[model samples]
Target: MARNQLLNITIWTALLAPVVYIGVMIVRIQNGEWDLLGPEPGRAVTQFLGTWALNSLLLTLTLSPLKRSPLSINLISYRRRMGLFAFTYMLLHLLAYMTMMLGWQWQDLNDEVVKRPYMVVGVFALLLTIPLAITSTRNWQRRLGRRWKKLHYSVYLVAALSMVHILLQVRSSWTEFVVYSSVLSLLLIERLLNRQKTA
Candidate 1:
C-alpha cells in the first residue's frame, strides 16, 4: 500500500511539474521578479526547462539500475511516464528557445545553427526521443517485438548527445557538466557490469 501510494505521488508530481513550473515562472516574470531569473529571463527559462528535461532522461536511465538494487520498489511501470515527460520537457525547451532566443526568426535560427553546433546536437537528441515516445505503448511494443529493445537503446545515445550539447555551451561553471557526466558514466558502467554478469 505504501509503495502504491509512493508511486501515485511520484506519477502525479511528474505530471504536474512542468505545468506548475511554467505557470510560476510566468507569474513571477509578470510581477517583475527579475532577480531570480537573471538579466536574460528568457535564456534562464530555456536553461531551466532544458535542465529539467535532461534530469528526466537521467531519472529514466536510473530506473533499470534501481530495479536491480536490493531496495528496489518496482518503479518500472513509471518508466514510460518519465520518458514521455522528458520528451515533453525537451519540446517545451525547444519552443522556449524559438520564442525567447530566436523570436521565431528562421534566418536567425539558420545562422545560430551554423554558429552553435550544440543546438544541432540538442535537436538531434530531441528528434530521437519522438519515435521512442510514440512507440512507448504496449501495442507498439508487441508489434515491434525484439526490435523494440534495440530501438529503445537509442536513449543512451540521446543522453550522451545531451551531455555533449550541455558541455558545448559557455557555462560559468563546469560543475553541472561534471555531475551529469559522472551520473551517466556510473549508469553506463552499471549496465555493462550487469550485461557481463548475465553473459
Candidate 2:
C-alpha cells in the first residue's frame, strides 16, 4: 500500500479503537456482563476516561517531535486527526461525568467548581481545549496562521491541568499518580528537546 493509504488506515484505527472499546464496555454493561451500579463505578469510569484522554494527548504531542526524527512524514499526518480524537474523548469524559454523576444540574456545576479544586482545574482544561479543537480544521489553520499556533500551545497547559485534575481526584492512588506524572514528564521533555533542536 501507498504511504498515504497506510497513514489513513493508522489514523482511522486510532480514532475508531477508543470508540469500539467504549462501545463494547457499554454493551457488556447493558447485557449484565458488568455491573455499572457498583460502588466504584463512577470512580472506574472517571479513571478510565481520564487515562485515555492523557494517553491520546501524549500521542498528539509526540507527533511533531517524532516527525523531526528519521520517521516518515506520514507519521506527522496523524497528528491533527489524533489531536481531534483526543478532544472528542476528553469531551465525552467531561459529559459523562456531568450527566451520570452530576445529573446535568447547573447548580451542581457551580458547587463543584467552587468546592472542588480538581474539578475546577478539569473544567479549565476543558475550556482550554475548546479553541484548539475548533481551530483544528484546515481552513482555520490556513486563516489563522501564527495565531493558530499560539492558541494550540494551550495544549501544554491543558495537559498540565489535566494531570493535576487526575492527581487530586486519585488521592490515595500513588501508583497511578506516579505513572501519569512520569508520562507527562516524558512528553514535555520530548517537546523541549524538539524545540531546542529547532532553535
Candidate 3:
C-alpha cells in the first residue's frame, strides 16, 4: 500500500492492541482469573490506561521532531489521529478509575480529588486535553486558523503535568520519571531550536 495507508493501518493496530488487552482483562475477571489482574483490577486497568494515554501523548509530540529528520516518513499527517487517540485513552483512563476504583461514587471521587494532590494535577491535564481533542478536526483547524497553533501548545503543559502525576506516585523508582523527563526535555528543546532557526 501507499505510505499514508500503511501509517493508517499501523495507527489502527496500535490503538486496537489496548482494547484487546482490556477485553482480555475483563474476560479473565469474569472467568475468575482475577489473580492475573491481582486484587484490584480497576486500579490495575486505570494505571494501564493512563500509561497508554501518556505514551500516545508522547508520540503525538514526537511527530514534529520526527518530521525534521532526514529519514522521516509522512508521520506529520498522522499527528491529529495520534492526539485524538491520546485524549480517547485518557478519557477511558478516567472512566476506569471512576468505575473500578470509586465504584462510580461521585462523592468519593470528589473527596479523593480534594485529598490527593496528584489527582488534581492529573485531572487538570486531562481537562486541558479536552479542547485539544475537540478541535483536532479539519473543520475546527480551518476555523481557528492562526489561533489553533497557539491553543495546541497546551500539549506541552499536559505532558509535563502527566510526568509530575506519575512522579509523585512513585515511591522508590525514579528511573521512569528520569527517562520520560529527559525525553520530553529533548523534544521541547528540539522544537524550540527549530522555531529559532525558522525565525
Candidate 4:
C-alpha cells in the first residue's frame, strides 16, 4: 500500500480499540460493575465518554506539531479523523448527560444548564464544535478559502472551554487537568513560535 494509505489503515484499525473499550464499559454497566447505579451509572458512562473527548481534542492538537517534526511519518491526514472522533465523543457525552443524568426531562435540562456552571461550559464547548465540525470537509475548506482558517482557529477556544469544564468538574484534583493543560500550553507556545518563524 502507499504510505498514506497504510497510515490510514493503521489509523482506522486503531480506532477500533475505543469501540471495544466502550463495549466493555456497556457490559460493565449492565453487570452493575464499579458500583455504578442510578445517578452514578449514568455519570460513569458520561464521564468516560467525556474523558475520551478531552483526550481526542488533545490528540488532534498534538498532530499538528507532530506533522512539523522530523519524524519519518506524516500525521496530517489523520487529523480529520481524530477531530471527527473528538466531536463524536463530545456528542455522546452530552447525550449521556442528558439521558442518564437528566433522564431527558426538559425542565431538568433547563435547570442543569442554568444552575450548573460546568454544564454551561460543556454545552458552550459542544456548540462551538458544531461549526468547526461542519466545516471540516474539503468542500467546505475550498468554499471558505482563507476564511476557513479563521473559523477553525476556534478550536483553541474550544480547547479552553473544555479545560474550564473539566477543571470545574475536578476542582480538587489537579493532576490530570494540570497535565493536559500543560500539554495544551506547550502546543500553543509551539504554534506561536512556528508562526513567528514562518513570518
Model 3 lDDT on a 0 to 1 scale = 0.88
For candidate 4, the C-alpha RMSD (Å) to the true structure equals 2.4
Q: Write the per-residue lDDT of candidate 4 for residues 1-199, one digit (tens) a residue.
A: 6976887787777655675677687788777675644457777778888988988888899887888878844677778889988899899999888877888889677767767789989889999999999999999999999999999989999999998987887857799889889988999999999999999
State in Å the error of residue 18, model 3: 1.3
TM-score of 2: 0.85
Ranking by lDDT: 1, 3, 4, 2
| All-Cα superposition RMSD per candidate | 1.7, 2.5, 1.5, 2.4
lDDT score for residue 72 of model 1? 82
Task: List the candidates' TM-scores in order.
Answer: 0.93, 0.85, 0.93, 0.89
Q: Rate the local accuracy (lDDT) of all candidates.
A: 0.91, 0.79, 0.88, 0.85
For candidate 4, give the lDDT of residue 93: 92
The best candidate by lDDT is 1
Tens-place lDDT digits, model 2, residues 137-166: 889999999998889888999998888987
Candidate 4 contains a number of clashing pairs equal to 0
Angstrom error at residue 164, model 4: 0.5
C-alpha positional error of residue 136 in candidate 4 after TM-score superposition, expressed in Å? 0.9
